[model samples]
Target: MREDAVKEGDKAPDFELERQDGGLFRLYELLKEKNVVLYFYPKDNTPGCTKQACEFRDQYEAFARLGAEVVGISSDTLESHQKFEAVHHLPFTLLSDKGGRVRSLYGVPRKLLLLPGRVTYIIDQTGTVRYVFDSMNKPLEHVSTALEVLKTISHERNTQNV
Candidate 1:
């Protein structure tokens, strides 16, 4: 990660992109409602990407129950994301990063100086980035790790109000 990269405890940088459905999605807007599991993948339809997405899909309901939303992003086109989402029956939002601007904002590093890196950020409803996991090889870990963090956040919030 770069020195200016969004880090844990920092307020997540707000941005908008064209979603799979062609609607504008702003991070700050989403932060108003639920904690976000904002993940950045390399591309669409690739084997690893597919499995990572499906892992999120399989755990979609659990994320919702924990008051978190799962969102995937990449430099792929809206059309490509639409196809990938339908083919995999992905139940979450997929955003098209036209020129990798958002990825750059988050300082998502590239793998082997070629491929875009796989990274996941857990941002709470208050817009603070609670956690970040950047692993090029562990796609499935993104889902499980994010869920664990969200569960902890939920527990903390409940205890805070008690």
Candidate 2:
């Protein structure tokens, strides 16, 4: 892991970017309401990226039930993201990071030093990163790993309230 990479328990670096719908998405604004399943992918229409987005869409309800929102970030343009969401029937926010600025903030490593790495960060409502999973070759695992971590965060929160 990169020494500068944001790790578990670190405060999530806040960022704002254009969403697919052409509206600004501010991370801290959303974190005020629910936990976030924030994923960084390389591209919009690529095979691995598509599979990862669809998996998140399929399990979206589970994430919401745990008081979380799914958000995907990539260097893809808003127009591309709009098309990608329409094609995949994605039911979450897609943020466009034109220059990989947010990706850099998270220290998301690149695959083979060429393609952007696939990574997932599970952030709680308070804006603290609870977990992070990095696996460029296992796109599907990103969704599963996020679900598991969200479940654990939910369980821990419930226990704390008791």
Candidate 3:
């Protein structure tokens, strides 16, 4: 693991990438509205990546209820992401990180030093990473873990207000 790898409580590295819709997406800009569940996957249309994306899609409403927005990033082309979103009916934004720069910025370690990493980062509205799940085999767990973390954060914030 890279020593500079983003960890919980660290500020998330900012990035800009093309959305599936061909529009630009800036990490800090999205952070202004709600918390972000930023996930980095390996590829588009692959079995594991598809399962992970669908899992996020299925739990998307729950994330929204918690005032969180889910975003997926991979080093795929914009056209590929568009097709993937259309085919899977993914409800959240999918960003195309063509060169994996953002992936490297997050210090997402490649699986076995070969394939791109499968990792998820739950970033709070304040731009701090609240949680990170790194796993290549258990894609579906990413959704459940992120949702749980977001719920915990929400609960903590509500309790502090009382």
Candidate 4:
């Protein structure tokens, strides 16, 4: 399959998706407020997705302190997200993209017929995609890698303003 993922410096296509918590999230709105870590996973409650979610949850406070918000998207329904979050104590937003529309906008590939491919996007404060990770074998590294990019950008912006 062709990798249609957005590249760094490209304006990320904003989307409106249903949250597992019964709310609507506009990607641009969140980007306007803070940098975003938009991650896409195969399925809710699955092994890899769960590991990715928990790692984000564990470091959620640091992400917030860095003025970034982490959000996960999957084709799963709101009910599934709710159950997964409750069972794992996830501390951030879980978006339910049942239609896979948002997933397609992000160009998340379909590696498995049964699961959405593992991918993550780090959006800068200006709403541009700063980084994209498409590998599923090393899920935990996704968080750290995204954080490093965000921190570098945040530092550079601060330095320029000073």
Best by TM-score: 1
Q: Name the candidate that leads on lDDT.
A: 1
Reference-based lDDT, each prediction: 0.94, 0.93, 0.93, 0.87
Q: What lDDT, from 0 to 1, does candidate 4 have?
A: 0.87
How do the predictions measure up, each by TM-score? Answer: 0.98, 0.98, 0.97, 0.95
Give me candidate 2's TM-score against the actual structure. Answer: 0.98
With candidate 1 superimposed using the best TM-score fit, by how many Å does residue 57's alpha carbon deviate from the native? 0.1
Question: What are the per-residue Cα lDDT tens digits for candidate 2 across 35-57?
Answer: 99999999999999999999999
User: All predictions: root-mean-square deviation over Cα?
Assistant: 0.7, 0.8, 0.8, 1.3
Between candidates 1 and 2, name the one with more favorable lDDT: 1
Model 4 compared with the native: what TM-score? 0.95
Pick by TM-score: 1 or 3, better one:
1
* Candidate 3 ranges with C-alpha deviation above 4 Å: none
Candidate 1, residue 134: lDDT: 93
lDDT of 4 at 33: 87
Q: Tell me how candidate 3 scores on lDDT.
A: 0.93
Per-residue accuracy of model 3 over 1-162 as CA lDDT, tens digit each? 568899999999998888888788999999999999999999999999999999999988999999999999998998999899999999999998878899989999988788999999999989999999999999999999999999999999999999
lDDT of predicted model 2: 0.93
| Residue 18 displacement in candidate 2 (angstroms) | 0.8
State the lDDT of candidate 1 residue by residue for 11-44, as single tens digits.
8899999889988999999898999999999989
